[model samples]
Target: MSDFQSPLEAFLYWEANSPNQVFLKQPVNGKMETYTFAEAGNESRKIAKALQAFNLPERSHIALLSKNCAHWMMADIAIMMAGYVSIPIYPTLNQDSIQQILEHSDSKAIIIGKLDNYATQKSGVKDIHKICVGMYNENDGELWEDIIKSTQPLETITLPSQDQLHTIIYTSGTTGTPKGVMHTVGNFIRSASIMKQVMGLPHGSRFFSYLPLAHVAERMGIATHGFVIGAEFSFPESLDSFASDLENCQPHIFFAVPRIWTKFQEKILEKMPKKKLSFLLTVPVLNILIKKKLKQKLGLKEAKFIVSGAAPLSINLIYWYKKIGIEILQGYGMTEDCIISHFNLPNDNKIGTVGKKLSTVETKLSADGEILIKNNCLMTGYYKSPEITASVFTEAGYLKTGDIGEYDHDGYLTITGRVKDQFKTDKGKYISPSPIELNLSKNNNIEQICIVGTGIPQPIALITLSELGKAKAKDLLIQSLSASVKEVNSQLQKHEKIEKVIIMKEEWNVDNGLTTPTLKVKRNSIEKIHQPLYKSWFKMEDKVIFE
Candidate 1:
């Protein structure tokens, strides 16, 4: 059970108990700005007063548009304090997407802060009431600091009922249009309680909040959990200062996506060649010293829990980090579940799997092998879409996770692939690309891979080269990739074997509309773009073909 009834109650508890303690540490133009619990509460109350002064209806939906920053959390608190529902939008979303979510969620007002490009996105807000943060130089609406300085504090705090609407987190739209996932105050409380208990989080733990707070993983893991334990949050100034800021904060609990982990590995390998690093790790004293240096460099030396999520990370990459004394605990969850499905604890970690189910989570497999989940923290439903929401759950009321998986004898679950990601070749056999993609990604040269066949004779691997691969000569890259294809093919069935490896000239990214903000590849987009070329690519004489 949670110590407090709601997130606001937890925040109030911390404010009363640890008023003078630092709650948020944000880096601005190389300078660190901190807000104590008392100070944050004061600002939040002032913002709440400003919102109330607008005369919005009770329980009106208010949207939060910002990158992960101190003000984003404050704005969320302000929304809750004003007795309104919060709707968070991904900062990386295009203008149309921003408009879609705001209109779909029926948000009355929006609090914008710490955005990279507000000029292009400001049009999406249209005539909605916007409270912009001046700290980031946003001028499209009423200034945040100006209101805080001018408005009086809201004295009356409104506590939400257990089942009252809390927030609507819109999906990243990798599949289609973004759908708002409606969560209640009780969901946040239960999720926070589970995270605090499962991780043994301390009151004063330092949290580095770099991931998009709009994302459920970051929102629950950092913001909600921080309020529960009075944790100190540190935000990077920008991408350029992320390394320095993280190093300075030395956060106790750190979470990053698989792409970020890969980037860190690439950065380390840039300075130290893979072969040399492997050789040095064999020496006892040097290995310990090197691991310590690596931890310090990655700003994880003080981290108690380091986790990777959002997508499947290669087991080889996990082992690579293990060699350097960092054990990445890979977990599994979705937006609908509030990310409380499964996690690998530090002591009970199962390397290849996404760990066992959380204490309160019940998991089972469907007839088709899809993972089904039921937990106290699950979202009530997708906002404004009853039919769509009803379709995603089983008749037994479990959330159909859409991902196929298997449970080992020890109850550890390994995700094989998504049910929708399976495709059939012209030969009539359906193939799951995720496992093949995972195996092929073990080659350090391959950065991203999407196995496609659809209506072709056999599946072909479409890939973008990694930094290491890009730096190598063309012949060397071909030789290396060919060997990988041959090796991976040796383990697969004849019908499921990849016929060719096609190296694409362009990389799939958020900007290209080929990847989600969390960096998960849009398999549908991949098929749409390259399905016609699959047969031709498969007919190529060479084992590896550069596009």
Candidate 2:
């Protein structure tokens, strides 16, 4: 193995040493197109040469607008090979967000590929040179196919210095407009090295890249790490083929958000009822077979590491998986630090807490119990937002995580809530919604929940039903939810008791602007639309009000 200094160096090393090894697998029109290290390198270099032909300034910002696909990774390499900074925009982002990121980053060019809806988004890329991937049917601009045919492969590829800027990753913006987080070559190398060591990710591992490669976690954990370790990556063609693709790949490592884990659980439950599964698991021989079958069905039979992050996974969900011979390690980190904060390893697994910090990571709690983190892998700063960046860091240089957490005696961190997520009731009692929401999520019927008490005397739960919940009879759902609400309130203080459980008819999602790209509920957006009706709903006679 070569001692690589940067992501580009890692790619170069593999391209030189093991050119025949398969690198990328893309499912195109139900057929997998495989790219070897040599082939991928050739394509990336050719794209880099074509980009140089555009005559953009050195270190010019180039934006990538696409979902997880083979060309996205190649484009990243092309940007680096061309000595430019990459800016990745979330594919699900609206036109306004796309325009804001491109304009703010001052991108000279954009590589658009593999989008579900390109027509609506192409209007956002005005005045920028566009290179579209024709394979994915994104042909609004200069085609990628023509560039490779007409251009020569760049032969004078130069390695980037550690201090040179690598990419600006825009946050998915759970609250407000997304901010560009600046990361350098050194940051990527350092973070990837630490994570590769900590997670024991081996050379030539198999990775399934379904998560948005634009996000830091997926960027570092899968795409970047795969490059560093000479791993093979397979991408799902679309939502319809996601399960089949994943099942076929059976990746060694799997990382998903809490929402994805919950969806998997729902899918499993839909196939096998809870009562039948419980009885089957109680039998000795059948239990092993059932667990193995379930693992294979979920495409995790060969997974060496299964991780959940981006949001707190419900502890009950973890326990439920544990009973089925799978242990989900809930890790914690944000985009600011390149997601090098903490994780629960297999040997030292903790159920309710996000496990201990990485070897080079430093963590401390602030006066208000907000988690503060300091690490060499942290981002340089927010792009074009110096004042906002300065405000996020303490005088001692720790990033204020905004998440409220408490470390157990042995150092496992349990996230209680968010600092800004707290709301004051009319009676002057402050309520942190996260912890309450986590508890409420234990109810299988509830898919999403937010606790709000802005103008009311008591906090009320705004909830959307899970598939299991939606499939149940109205009377059954009300009875089950009412019991859950009663059970949760019984364990809380008088002021903290939930006033009522209001089941919202509309599900919060990215299209509706109620959730982030990662599926985290946008509390601010939810409050803006529903707060006015809170009082009226609170005064209703029903304990479980269906809205």
Candidate 3:
């Protein structure tokens, strides 16, 4: 059972028990600003009183647009305490998307906090009540400091029930337009209860929050989890200062997506070449010293538990990290599932699979091999899209996760590919690109890759080379890529083999609509952009085609 029914109740309990304990830390300019439980609770009550002064109808929808910061949590708590639904907008979204989410959710007011570029987001937005968290121009909105100072704290706290609507999070939209996924307070409480058990962190555990707070994984894993366990949440000032911030905090529990993990590996290899490190590890005494030093340098020596999610992690990457004494556990979940479906626990972990389902969640495979889940943590539905919501579930009420998967004898789940990502060739042969892509990505030279061959005889790889790969001579790079491709092809059937490799000059990113915020490749977008080049590349005689 959960200790508290709602997040606000959790905050209040912590405040009453440990009013002087620091709960949050955020960097401002260059110095760190700390917030105690008492301070945060008082500030939230003040903001709630200021919001109630508007006298809007009950259960008003309030939108928050900001990067990860201490004030962002304050705004979220205030929204819930005021009996309002919180809609979090990704700070990286363009003006058109920001406007569309605001209009779709029917938000009555907006709370603006720290952002990279506020003008771009506020460009087309007007006629809405804006409450700014920090410094802003007069035309932007009302100042947060001023409003909180003028208003009194709420005399009576409005406690929310478990079934009440809590948050409506909009999907990052890797395939198409974004949709709002509605989750209730009960969903959060139950998910947090299970996580509190799984993590087993003490009251003063430290967490570093760097990912987008709008994303479900960060929201539940960091924000909700911190609130429940009374953990200290730390936010970095900027990307340039991330290394220093991470080392200074030395988080007890760390979570990162696979892209970040790959980057960390590249950084380490730059300091000590892979060949030398491998040779050193073979020596008896030097191996322990080298691993300890490497972990300390990367600020992971103090991390008790590390997790990687949001995309498929290559087993090679997991093994590489393990050599440095950091065992990364991979997990699987989506926005609609409240981000607590499956996890690879310590001491019982499998390298390739996404681990077993949580004790609270029930899972089964559909007739077509799609993974289906039913759990207390599942979202209520997509907001305002009844048809789209109904189509995502079975008549028996299991959520159809769209990804094809298989289970091991021990009930561990291995995701094979997406149902929509599979394609057929002119010869009537179907291919699943994920397993093939994973094998090809074992090459350190390849940073990002996608396998595309919808209408051709055999599949071809579209790759964005890493910095080291790009710096090498053209002939040398081609030689390395060709050897890796041949090794991967040797394990595959004749029809499933990749005929050629195309080296792409352009990079894929969230800003360019090629990847989601969580770093998952937008396969549909990639195919649409590169499909026309397939025939031309296939006709080339060379096995490695440079574009």
Candidate 4:
């Protein structure tokens, strides 16, 4: 393998060396559409030529709104080859967010691909050129297929310099409006190189790209890393076919957030009741058989590396997966750092921590306990927001991560909570809600939860029960949750103890604006929605307040 300076060079190298090797397998219209290295390279070049024909200025931003697809990757590569910065928008975002990102990034054109609802998304934009990737009936843009067939491929590919802007990824805002994080080609190369060295994935390793590619973590971990290591990438047809897709791909490396891991646990327990599965595992011979069979059934028997990130995972969930012969290593990083900060490695793994800092990264705790980092892969800054960008870094030049964390003796870092998420009570004592939430989430009955106590005497929990929990009698569900709440409260300080656990009447989700696209709880949004009930819930005599 030859050393490459940029991502385009890497793609070209694979295209020349392994022309016929399958690079992407995308399920389209109930059929698999495969793209070889040469095909993807050729298509991207054509797209680049079409983009150049538009005569946009150098380094103009091109926006892409789509779910995970092969066309999404092709568009991104084309944007880079045409000397333009790619700005990806989450497909699930509402019209307001879509309009905000488009205007903020100063995007000249947008490529619309697979989305849940395009009519609403398209109506929000006022002025911008639109290009349709697939079959869309709207009269807004030219079809990608038409451009590829008519336009000639670029005679020469303009590879970007290390310092040149590559993409502007908007953060998935859990608290407020999203910021456009600027990343250069050098940042991605450094991060991917470090990841390649750390994981040591063999050539032709299978990668299933189910997560939104717009997110930096998915882009770096699956798309960029796959290209760097010459891995085969596969995309699911749709959410309905996710299971079959996973089974078909049987990926060598798998990455998912905590919510997905929890869902997996629920699915397994649904098939085989926890008590029965526990009993079978107690027998020596049955234990081995059951573990192997279960992993195979879940299509993770071939996975060499399993990672969970985006949000804090419960320690008990990790232990539960370990019992089934799958060890999930939790990683911690943000968009500003190219999502390559800390990760747990095999064998040297710490159960509850996000693991030690990566070899290429430097980290230290701030005076106020915030995690500060200085690394080669850090983003250039927030696009067009120099003041805001400057505020995020410390005087010592380290990125002042809003998250508060601590390191153990061996240098394993445990995320205690987020500084922004901490709240004060009427008693004037501050509380971090994440640790308490993690403890309560260990209860199999709890699906999702948020702890809030701002301006109140004692903290309160708003919880959404799991399917199993909801199937049981209401009294039984409350009893189980009460026991779990008491157990968690026993470990907390007096001011931090939860006063009540209120069962939420409606499910919180992305469509409902209660959760982010990545499934992180939108604490501010949830609080606002339930603000009216706070006083009434506080006055309730029962410890578990069920609606």
Best lDDT goes to which candidate?
A: 2
Question: Per-candidate TM vs. native?
Answer: 0.98, 0.99, 0.97, 0.98
Candidate structures ordered by lDDT, highest first: 2, 1, 4, 3
Better candidate by lDDT, 2 or 4:
2
Candidate 1 accuracy as lDDT: 0.90
lDDT tens per residue, model 4, 9-57: 7888888899999998888777888999989888888988888888898
Over 4 Å off, model 3: 135-139
Return the candidate ranking by TM-score, descending: 2, 1, 4, 3
Better of 1 and 4 by TM-score: 1
The residue pairs that clash in candidate 4, if any, are none
Task: Please write out the lDDT profile of model 1 over residues 445-465, one tens digit for every residue.
Answer: 888899998888889999998
Model 4: CA > 4 A from native = 135-139
Best by TM-score: 2
Q: Relative to the unseen true structure, what is the C-alpha lDDT of residue 347 in candidate 3, on a scale of 0 to 100?
A: 84
Stretches off by above 4 angstroms in model 1 are none
What is the Cα-based lDDT of residue 187 in candidate 2?
A: 94
Model 2 C-alpha lDDT per residue in residues 388-467, reported as the tens digit of each score: 99999999999999999999989999999999999999999888988889998999899999999998999999999998
